[model samples]
Target chain A: MDVIQIVVIGLIATVLIVVVKTQRPELALLLSVAAGIILFLLVLGKIGSIIDIVRDLADRAGIGSIYLGTILKIIGIAYIAEFGAQICRDAGEGAVATKIEFASKILIMVLAVPIVVAVLDALLKLVP
Target chain B: MEAIRSLVQNLIVIIILAMLLEMFLPAGEMRKYVKMVMGLLIIVAVVQAVGELVRWDYRDEIPPLTEKNNEAELSGIMAAASRITGNQEQKALEQYKSGLSKQVRALVHLHKETPVLEVDVKVQSGRNEPDYGQLKEIILFVAGETSSGKESEGAVKEGVEPVTVQIGSTIETDEHIENRDSPAGAAEADLISMVANFYNLSTEQVKIIYR
Candidate 1:
């Protein structure tokens, strides 16, 4: 049911962008970004439910909430960064999109640093 | 055997969760980094599961990440709160001192015979002191008889020196009143007692410096 609504929105946005692109490229870009945000918003509730299920599964398995939280955060950051980069690419700023991706990679690495260290530490402990 | 079975079950659940999360990862450039992190999560889960089986206490080596973050953030919040409280307390004390000085100056103005030039009030500000915020002393600068013309500002500034009456305790003030040889001294003593009584303070605490 929601899929139909999303598809309709995407179709309408595509037609509008095709119609407006020749007149004002900047407005077309804005229209595309707005459409992306609208689509994301429509599915935001579903994302929350999915996250809750993951958290519940993590709890049931006796996995620490911290690990689950970090994984979720990484997923969120990746999603946002990918969205931003795509927007930049759509605006014909490939260099800016690349930079955004680079920043996201670094941020993702920083968030993973502790886990990496923990893994290394555990490995070292097991060796001894 | 039961513990081994449960450990395997936890590992299976963690793997399944990891697979589910991988499905949500953004395609293209970001996918590899997300997948790598996901792989690390699985590794961590496996290591923890093995550690649990052996009773090695893997969690002890690495602290609760969220709790550590929260503790650091909590300390920062507490520091900011204390800093704000100290600044607010200092501001309140300054306002209280200035307000008291204005009240004392106005109270002295009620006396037509002795014109007050200035009033300095000190209050007990020590937070630990039993009499904190209580008035400590009131120093009144009363104009002398020679400059009592009320417009003798220049004369008072240059030549005529105001009399200094240091009032202390109710008994000392009464003694000073008895020993007062000049009419002006007697009037100054009366003015001091009136103020002391008005503020419900001891006459000794109200000191008048005639200028």
Candidate 2:
């Protein structure tokens, strides 16, 4: 679905949640969380499709499939770390969340080292 | 999976019923354990339900075949890339075939000939400048040329390289000659106009970089 459809559905869901909250606050919270999750799943599907296309293109470009995999894995790590950190903050464990974010960055940097080394190798070979 | 789902659903019902029963029963030490069990059962039930759903969805689907060689897939990928990078795929392919002989002798390391690169045009209006719809037309004109597959490949290998073209007047002030905007009592108004103009981007399309 397009951005407009997603926004309209979100707004409708938010309105339903607000109305439900007035009667059953607990159920309303649950429904709100479910709506957010459903939306997240939809967006995640789009991102996965995009990543697949990028991977295919990178492979065709002779950029190496492994390099694309590394980039995607790095992206996944960053996203998961951010996701965990956000959940921690929502649970009032901001310190733990911050630690998770820090760890994710360090891990990403480590993961990127191989690509960096390969790029350097490519450049050096180009130098004569 | 079906059995697991049924078990989990039953467990949820049991937990809810237990919580309700505890509300009526006497407030004793057992109440705490009952509530704890209720929470554990609920978590277990939800996890099992989700797992069952995933299993059921994938049960009939064939697993993707693993392939080490991706040369054919790579060609399809290049075609998609041509479309994405605004090159005519057919044109690029034709150019690739025609130029293969020339490229083979020139470069021994690179197997495939690189397509002609495209230039990107970025036009920015002044903060107080009026919006011009013509900019969009210009961008489309520059971007739209990738109709043939041959031309597309040619563009990718040896097309006009992409370049950003910026068009706007720089603001000048006594304090700073290279100021982005005119500074005066109109700071807020100027800033708002600048922001609005910035959002009104036109012709951010890719163009071929002709040699």
Candidate 3:
């Protein structure tokens, strides 16, 4: 979305949250969560294009695609987990947000497993 | 240029996004975290765009800055030059003033053929004095002249008191002839030259008063 539209929507959501929060805290929290998710989805398309561009450039440079893919996935996990954690925290579910962060850390390491194995395999072959 | 243009565009978008988050986010710990994360992401995006530019060898597409480099160096050199000149001017003024006093005492002692008893020098309404170049000219004028006779040596043998004068003020009667006020002529010209030269000034620039 364009900047102006995002700003308008954010302002409207902020006012709505403020008005409902005292009377209905849960509803206010849900509305904020919805707004956050919508903003993330709006930027996701642009991010996808940027990723494609990076991938193409990396391919042209003759770099292995696996490492690049792993890094991109890690970054994607970081962003999504952070997003979810923010939504959870805003909902006053701080414990839930903490657990989400812990899960994302494990998920990122899992995604890096192939790169780690590949490096180890290469190092083993280099041994005289 | 395209890389830079897109970087600026993305940064603008990130800034708008930040403003939105800051406004809509609840005022608490989570809001702080979101702002921090958003700021970092914006920084990452800017760096990524710059990295793209570097990879494309975009720097070569731009012209060199030899002239601008020289300009900056010249400006730095000029600043140092001005500082040196300022210190030089202060030293010149001080040296000139000191030399002027010494020359006046020496000339007076030579003129009277006796050492001065006592002298007092004062600066009255004085500053922005002549510089070393003018002092050089004055010292040259006096250097070429003789103390004018063998009598000065004889008088020195007589145990005359030393001569003195306030470089810019009055001296005791015995030390100076107060002879500077003598009219412009052969005898007075020497003293007039003394006064003029002491000031590193011209005869016209020197004002003589007899007391």
Candidate 4:
């Protein structure tokens, strides 16, 4: 039922964007961004539940919170960067989209610094 | 066996998490970068779990590298570790000294002629010393008169005499002369030599104080 509602809203938004794009391109872009945000918000509630499940599983498996935290941060950064980049691409700003993605990649690597150091430290301890 | 079971369980959970997280990833170039980080996290988890199985403690997880200056933090950790080591060494030395003193007291008590009131033993505890933990000195505090017999007759006379050191290089020249002149000096010397021989120490290392 929720999917039906989402599909209907998406279709209506697409129709409105198609009808308005020729007359007012800026308005159409705004409508598309608005629709994307609405759809993301609708799905966001479900994402929280999925995250809770992952957290429980990680706890049971004896994984450290730090690793899980880093992974979660990377995922969030990727999702947000991808969302922004896609919007930029839709607006015909390919260069801006590329810059957004490059920034996200750097942020993800920065977040991963601890895990990388942990791996190296563990290996070093095992060696001697 | 329990560790193996838990390791398998952990791997399963990690794989499931990776799959679920992968589904959340965008179908774009950013996916690769995110996946790389997830892969490293899984690697660390697996390595740490294996370390636990081998009885090697991976308790000290590495802290965030970018949080502070690495050299300063490393030096701080080194200093703390050395301080803990020093405290433990000092405690062990104290216990060793007490235990050695008790053993010496018990040994001297075997000879009823000398009733030992107290025993003090010192050991070379310096790490740099070649004779570390070797008996450095043993001081026995004995009653003024022999506890075996003729105690009533000799106690008053022995009590009137001043404290005397039967052996040891640290003894004053006058005390050494007085110790030699004492009536029971030969018997005390024999007892002191017996103690030195038992501890593998030189005669001078074992000192007896008549109190």
Instruction: Name the best candidate (by lDDT).
Output: 1
Query: Residue by residue across A1-128, what tens digits does model 2's lDDT show?
Result: 47887798789888987898779877766666677677778787677666665555443333455655655565566656666676566556789988987787677667666665665554443332
Candidate 1: Cα lDDT at B67: 74
Misplaced by over 4 Å in model 3 are: A123-128, B1-211
Query: For this target, which candidate reaches the highest TM-score against the unseen true structure?
Result: 4
Which candidate tops DockQ? Answer: 4
What tens-digit string does per-residue lDDT give for candidate 4 at B144-177?
6543322211122323544555575565422324
| Deviating ranges (above 4 Å) for candidate 1 | B56-211
Tell me the tens digit of each residue's lDDT in model 3 across B75-113: 999999989987887676666566665756666566542
Docking class of 3: incorrect
lDDT of 1 by residue, B178-204 (tens): 334455556676778888898888877
TM-score of 3: 0.37
Please give, as one word, the docking class of candidate 1: acceptable
**Backbone clash numbers for all candidates listed:** 5, 41, 6, 0
RMSD of each: 17.8, 36.8, 22.1, 13.7
DockQ of each: 0.45, 0.01, 0.03, 0.49
Indicate whether candidate 3 or candidate 4 has the larger TM-score.
4
RMSD of 4: 13.7
lDDT for residue B20 in candidate 1, whole number 0-100: 86
